[model samples]
Target: MLILTHTLYLNRPEGEIPIAIRIYRPEPKDGCWACTFEIDWPEGTKTMSGAGLDALQALVISLQMIGIQIYTSTYHHDGALRAYDNEEGYGFPIARNVRDLLVGADKIYL
Candidate 1:
């Protein structure tokens, strides 16, 4: 079942794109929750996921992975004008900001 959903905007050279992040429920694994985040672009879509002890951590980890993609995609489009470095936490914060909305169906803790 779907636990929660969030959206983030990534700055690409072509323009801005909305990245949809989602979490699914499957009980739990090793006491951690599972989540999957997807980045959809005009070219295609890429998926990344993570498991965490709680909902927020799961969301954060998944977001971090998407952040890496955002960084790489931005770099691919225009390396010189990219916003933040991969080491600087990439688009994770950008994704996490969606938490302010807290629009999940379950205990997402987002």
Candidate 2:
């Protein structure tokens, strides 16, 4: 069982929403992880399942269903933080310190 918490700003009228996500891996079959997820959102609860290389990938897809995008970047020399805004001139610091870069891919949920 892998658990993650994320605060997301939705485009809907309700605005920011806090969600609790849980991923469960029953057993590996044929060298693949069979993952299922349970999302506890403000509105209600939802569950889903899919096949992924790992649990993280499965979580990414579950979040995408609610309009969240998760990904990584290799453009920077140190391979900038995952989900950092890649758009030109967005006001994010170009040279981020270890603390900021170490935030991890989960920070995108914020």
TM-score (C-alpha, index-matched) for candidate 2: 0.35
- Candidate lDDT scores, in order, read 0.53, 0.41
Q: Per-residue lDDT for 2-110 in model 1, tens only?
A: 7766555556668766656555653366767767666565567666667788877776777656554654465334533222334222234325444342222211432
Name the regions of candidate 1 deviating beyond 4 angstroms: 1-27, 74-91, 94-110
For each candidate, how many residue pairs have backbone atoms clashing (under 3 Å)?
Answer: 0, 0
Reference-based lDDT, residue 56, model 1: 74
lDDT of 1 at 55: 73
Q: Which 10-residue window in model 1 sums to the lowest lDDT? A: 101-110
Judged by whole-model lDDT over C-alpha atoms, candidate 1 comes out at 0.53
The estimated TM-scores of all candidates read: 0.47, 0.35
Check candidate 2 and list the clashing pairs. Answer: none
Measured on C-alpha atoms, candidate 2 has an lDDT of 0.41
